[model samples]
Target: MRTKPIRALATLAAMITISSTALLTGAADTHAADVHAEGTHAADIHTAAPPGLESLVDTAVTGYLKDDRIPGAAVTVVSGGKPVLTKGYGVADVRTRAPVDADRTGFFLGSLAKLFTAQSASQLVTEGRIDARADVNDHLREATVPDTRPGRPVTLDHLLTHTAGFDSDLVGRNKASAEDVEPLAEGLTTRRPPRVRAPGQVAAYDNYGYALAGQLVADVSGQDFPAYVDTRILRPLGMTHSTFAQPRPPRIAGQQARGYRPDGASGWTEAKGQYGSWSPAGPGAVSTAGDMGRWLTDQLTADSAANRLMRQVHYRQDPRLPGLGYGYEEWRRDGRTGWFKDGDIPGFHSTLLLLPAHDLGVFVVFNGDGTDGRAAVDGRNLIDRVVDHLVPARPATPEAPRPSADPALATYTGSYRAARVSRSSLMAVEGLVGAVTVEKDGDTGLRTTGLSVDPQHGEQRWTALGDGLFRERGAGGATLAFTGDGLLVSSATPATAYERLTWRQSPALHTALLGFGLAVAALGAIAYPATAAARHLRRRDPHPRAARAARAAAAVTGLLAVTFAASLAAVVSDANAMMEAVPLGSPLLTAVTVTGTALVVTTLGVATGAMAAWQRGWWNRTARVLFTLTALGCLALASMLLLYHLVTAPLTWITG
Candidate 1:
């Protein structure tokens, strides 16, 4: 109510933004790089090192197999455009205990497949068949991106860098089998996500954008995406172990490392039906660590125009911060910048890291997402460790930053949410939990909370470098800039940015409202019947008939509200299942909508009765006040639910 109508509309307009991994928005849960440190604390599974780099890598890989950390994993290390090590760890199948073969085992590549799509599009760009800066519709044969901004069309550049502004969607991202898949062009044309931001502005990791890139590659090259990638890219790189074919071409059909989900404390549930038709966005595409290593090695050497294009920095939110390449996300470690990409599906996780500074690259794929779903986190940690071990850095003293010339230090102090989060769906809830708070640290410094980043401490202090940009205080080389029309940009995550959140959209306020409402409703549920029973036992004067009706309405409102809350909880317990369930018109979603309707209706009745009780003098002033508070609590709870788009039947969040 406090928000002006015009500002509220603006907020709603801004709500069309994105999240990653459905990602914890997939929070880019389309992750760029796990900043677990360029020198990992744990990714280096071993403390002791052998004589050679290859031997050291082998020891680190074999460390994974020891603690039952992951059932299976594949690793490939390349330096100077040559394979330093290509190895497999643990078993491909826990049930059969099939030993993983690095060159033979095919593991699902999640969003890392975008690298291929980017490469394909890059090739077309090199051939002058597709324009990197032109509207993508110019090259598409079947799919067309809507002109959300009349002057700005989503170009091949936007799609590749995750800056196309498409909303992230997890719907249909995972399927039981390849047979359930839809055709690429059909899905692209029909299921295009709304362009929430202008093309070439802000990076939001989008699977749909990559799918469009793949379609663009297919359209211009006159070959299917898979076949083109197979003949033109994979085969040429000598990546014989890789294929984009769903159900995986017959050669690698039985070669897959079965994905697994932890069943309980120790058990494993073999994950099935995990592939989807978003071939270029990941899933359905398969590659071994050894093959993925070749892909990494190729990046270091730049064998073709496409590879070089893919490696070039195409976009940056802030020059002081890490920028994005074609499909590769820019990452920094020990002040050594490099290309990094991480991917995750249901039970599979992978990371491709290229430290071109040292001519080093690492590719890691896990059959299991680990018990905590941190396969990417662990793998990135592993990468940093290897790089740190092989590559030595002579630390340079950071130049003390001159104070920011920009006068408005207070302008940067506020709570912010990631731009990659959803605005129009239940996924908007991600915005609440992922809030990043920035507060003034000194005359020219800011201390950011909630990022939980920085290699040493989860928190970081930023000393101003003028122009609203700040660098980390000491050895940490991270940079933060207030750009994108005042959006917060960081060197750590190029694909994600942060925007200031207002009071009406404040997660703390909303959470407090819901908590208070739930608490009051639950208390009323207990107090109403108990009070009636006590009065009866005490033989007190019976309330008037209309008064009894009012009391009954209040009690029912409380019960229904609590019931709706419970139903909502059960439905959203697993984000992945909810993504699949919501689009299919989930039965639980139906129940929630039904329960919510009843709760809303009863809340209205309670509000009406509150008025009646005040007019009729049906109870003591204290009792009347209590009843009114209960009514307000129920209304607040319902309002909170409505704010999240939870009351609608067949609750769909995919693009709202």
Candidate 2:
């Protein structure tokens, strides 16, 4: 099995934030006004047509669906507080051949549900029920966020802006059914992730932080989190087709667009949807395009206290941009400001963008997970294309200071790790090996490698933008600035920051160490069988019992290596399949877990037998030394696996 990059659904949401920067690209001049056609939804309002908007949108969406082989999607565009276009493309149910209905179809909102949670929290603040800056623990009844830093309590503001400093943990939280889902308080307590940083100091996109916020909402509002959201936000906005319920409400239960994954050459396979115990933290919302349109419209035009509070800029992750404020991620360029939120889970992807300056909003939902080469149909990119068509970029402003070879630049040359990283599992290995290296480029420019996942094209050039800020040469409108606090900030996604690290803690060093260790283990495992066979052929066997024990150790060590390789292959080859299987229980997981346990036991046995052989002096020095080394190596390998959670018992409730 090839090692596939297995990302939890929570990680998928964080990835969306990184990818959203690409949405600002494309040529302008295509206006939504041109696509002025009323949708099937009775509430849709139409205005003057801009002539070519409809065709432009249709062409883009149709091409995306076909190219990516996505089964279905729904898009709603709102201009001047009215929905100008609401449309659905392709089948909602592949099995039933049901056509997607923009007004009726409910797609999982994924992390976008965080927007509602944020709104709920903000609403409480507006109603004087909760203070944005108050300690979150004051309102919690079921769980408590321990104070990692004295005098700095995790606040509603911190949670809203994703600066609560919680370490990322999704294991055993993404439950596939209501039965598996735990109550918000119990769930948070059970999977209570540690705060890795001081609250309000660093921005780390956290689903658990939002989950805590939901619990706060439930406690303060005296209503269930979902009920409060529905009554206060959804229903009040006339979003009747939307529900935050996990198993889904009866009214919209049958209307769900089944999530899908690519089935190799055989076409699409329906994916079992996931429900998290921290559903309110992110995920577990079902909504339609029409309902989303209404929600967007209210966001754009409503004067409600909660709506007003949601729009307020609370914390800016990037000093160069407006950054993340409250429930929405905000961006400003060329005098225009926009707020957006994106969501991604196993089988569903959604994005909501509101351009308050233009009084325009766009919502997109894809039923199929983009793992099947359909990532190009990104909701952010889709919205960006539409935005460009309607409100094109203004002329470029005067350039900032040119790059200069300042000797002081050496201070910036180092490795930086993403502020948000996987903790408490083997996934931490990724963070360990994924640091970005900044090196001085020709004269004035700097080159950054490993900032992106693409190893072949990882290097990005940056020219100084004054004030310790460096702007990417060809990033269009993106920028990266070095903060006084030894952090790197990106204008594109202000919700995430990167922390600079010392040489010893660099990703390059850790990656090299891991590679070297693995290589030695592989060589030893391979040489064991070859050496044994050669010895047997030569009839040189001595101390038969010890030899047999050595051979058994070698075989078990080889099996461990093979198991690790297979696990990685399973992840790389079909991550979605692996994700679906892990939460539901699968034979593959059983095999790997059982084999891993055996490897641990066998390794220990080898270590004990090798000690006995060394004490008894039953073999030649070379044979005893080799056996001792092999035993030690096996133990080390097993220990590494155990430390990384590789050999842990299979988790039936965790979904990637």
lDDT of each: 0.70, 0.68
Error of 1 at 518 (Å): 1.8
lDDT of 2: 0.68
Q: In model 2, where do residues sit more than 4 Å from their true spots? A: 1-45, 147-150, 333-335, 371-373, 399-406, 432-434, 449-459, 523-526, 529-541, 544-551, 578-643, 649-656
lDDT of 1 by residue, 1-656 (tens): 00011011122212221111111111111111211111111222222332476566556655653333467787877776677677776677766667677888888887788888888888888988888888888888788887768998888888888888887545334567777778788877666667788877777767788888998899899998899999998999898878887667777878888876544445456555456666888768888877776677677877688777877888888777788898788888665778988876666778878887788888888887554444556676678778778877547656745657457777898888777675555445556555787988878789987664322234678888787888787764678889748689887778777878888888778777877777777778888878887888999956897777777887887777667665655555443334334433355656666776677667788888889988988799999999999988988877766665555534344225
Minimum summed lDDT over a 10-residue window in model 1 is located at 1-10
Per-residue error for 435 in candidate 1, Å, reads 1.3
Q: State model 1's lDDT.
A: 0.70
User: Highest lDDT, which number?
Assistant: 1
lDDT of 2 by residue, 122-204 (tens): 88898898988989888888788876688889898999898988877554456666566667788889777777778888887
Assess every candidate by TM-score: 0.82, 0.85
TM-score of 2: 0.85
